[model samples]
Target chain A: MSRINDVGGMEGFGAVPVDNAEQPAFAADWEARVFALNSALLRRGVYNLDEFRDAVERMPPAEYLDASYYERWFAAITTLLDERGVLPRADLDG
Target chain B: MSADHGDGALAARVRRAETLLEERGVVDGAELDAILDRYLATGSPANGARVVARAWTDAGFRDRLLADANAAVTELGFRAGGLQPTLLRAVANTAEVHNVVVCTLCSCYPIALLGPSPSWYKSEAYRSRVVRDPRSVLAEFGLTLPDTVRVEVWDASAETRYLVVPRRPDGTDHLDDDKLAALVTRNGLIGTAAV
Candidate 1:
């Protein structure tokens, strides 16, 4: 069989990693649930449609970080959602 | 049902209050403090642990998960994205190795499923580092690889959402769903740890 367990005695184990804090809160359950929710929309084609994808592909890789860069993406996707009828502009802007 | 309506009204009031707070330049920071003091007395969905758990259990479901975790979740109840709910995706960690998840543009989390995110998750440290050298960052988390596993990085933006589902641990096949879920920590769920 393919090698399963690892040096950590965590063989056959699959995961991200652990926290480095004095208190390993291990308290991100709700975070996972909500995260799953948003991605599900994208995978199903409910969030970013073709236009948004094209806009992102065309936009520069954003060599520098700026609030405007964030705004640009938001605008692109919001515009796409309005155009595709997934979300009415009012839902976003208002 | 009355209690449900009451909760809805409370949430609406919170949103209305937050909007007014924003207009006043208060932002989500102060509001979060208040939310913590008041509403989160028991617990809430911002943590992102349980959401990761669901992502680990099933495979056909995992495919559905990465494809569109929201509808999969919405079929149950929670909703997110602006005033209403939207989809949240979770990536799976398999046998051969590394994965890093982040929303490079904005903080699009699986809020309905997970709870408040770790402060680091929302910072430039995670957003910048993961894309640059995922292996190094994973190493910082004590996740060393043997060069056989391929690392996959996913950038979540306001446009898309994602969480990482850690691989199930060894020798725990005997653990049932709930037990298995118990080991699915927040960091593990976020691709920071193996289950």
Candidate 2:
């Protein structure tokens, strides 16, 4: 079940890009805050790092591939909170 | 390619989550923002570059860094505590062998040393393929090694982080610390590119 996140040595992954020098530390303000939010939540013991990573692992492969980096974090964290019944759909649907 | 300003829906959802966390008294908005801002300011690849430059110039420091990377970083003012993971390991690339870093499960990296990881590092392509065929992956980064040289791929995890210390390039023997640090790119520190 957790094997989904262990992506090493899998085949069919294409060419690696050459634009590593171009990216900023983060793309947008919200993106940085989202990362910070994960850190904050981890520090506050809302969930452990392993559980957070497990949430990400359980995301659909297609959605995981298409979303931006922090977008995935947002999705995964929201999924985790909702699953735990800590945050309802109404809270995030706004 | 067109720019990505980030997803609006995701941002809105994150905002709502922030509000909820505040309402639940899990974290205060202002306090969290301040901590993130501090990390954003001090955590960068430049910190790693400086560490490499010092190692290149000072033999004693190099010994200390290679022996205990986590503590060595503190000597350069990058203190680790209070949620900062302590198991950072520094690897060196010599003429006979090279090192590359990847996180197969997630993009677990030494953020304080390398700044936030580049998006590609977190991409499924790089994460999955790098460890399998590091030479080819390095080639894509415009680095090709001789057949005689060996490649070692380090998989970073939540418990342990890795930093690459590349062999200093020739013709820089006369350079000062700042000048040498300038030549150490973020990719060099990640072992995808030579300094």
Candidate 3:
């Protein structure tokens, strides 16, 4: 199992005690639609990106299986977006 | 502290919204959920298995599906109507070559059979690369359809959708429905591999 440094995401997740936001360390295409969705989830507090990040930090190398992991991430983010007014209630709760 | 992380509740919410729109004749909720959940759990749709099975069993049905997948599929029993309707045509694979589907515009997948799209399919990299050079892309996924194999790429824009009608693998003729279904993996539909 690789440590947080080996996998290369712990620092990016508001973990690893980042010294600056300017040099944002992120995974590929974080500015894309889905990543935006994840950030929105965290900002809106629908779920805990912090906790999720913590989980990621602790995860072994093999846990990042197919799209399911990413799907779960998207689900968490979308749930928050729906909870907030940014996305309509019907668009989420319907 | 929260109630969303437990299942695919977030995606369910998105699907729920789509369903409401569908109710007002904007989209098809049944079709949307059937498509979405396939990706949520199985990474593919059950209809993929159904299509593959039928293609192997009946030549006439195979011909019909290849000509017009939506119509032939409807004959077998699956809803094929909606507001922004999609017409699914099949691309058959032969010994000489194979066919694969990718929506260059977006990930316009066959929602009728395959539910929601996995993250990889929707990525700009996959959408852009699959059409221009499928052999290289498929190779990255550990699949290489031979040069002899005619690699016809269907551009699945928002207008028309497509699905890969994978050839039945050898030693599968005697297998029953369940066994055959098990063989139809998501990668096979993407023309990345055979079961």
By lDDT, the best candidate is: 2
The residue-by-residue lDDT of candidate 2 on B58-139, one tens digit each, is 9898988999998998898985332655588889899999999999888888888888788788877898899888988999
What DockQ does each candidate score versus the true complex, computed on alpha carbons? 0.05, 0.60, 0.05
Please provide, for model 3 over B68-92, each residue's C-alpha lDDT reduced to its tens digit, 9 standing for 90 to 100: 7878987767644322577777777
How would the docking of model 2 be graded?
Answer: medium
C-alpha-based local distance difference test score of model 2? 0.82
DockQ of 1: 0.05
Ranking of all predicted structures according to lDDT, beginning with the best and ending with the worst = 2, 3, 1
lDDT of 1 by residue, B84-156 (tens): 3444666777778556666654355654455555555654456656766678777877778778899887776
Q: Which ten residues in a row are the worst by lDDT in model 3 chain A?
A: A12-21
Ranking of all candidate structures by their TM-score, best first: 2, 3, 1
TM-score of 3: 0.55
Docking class of 3: incorrect
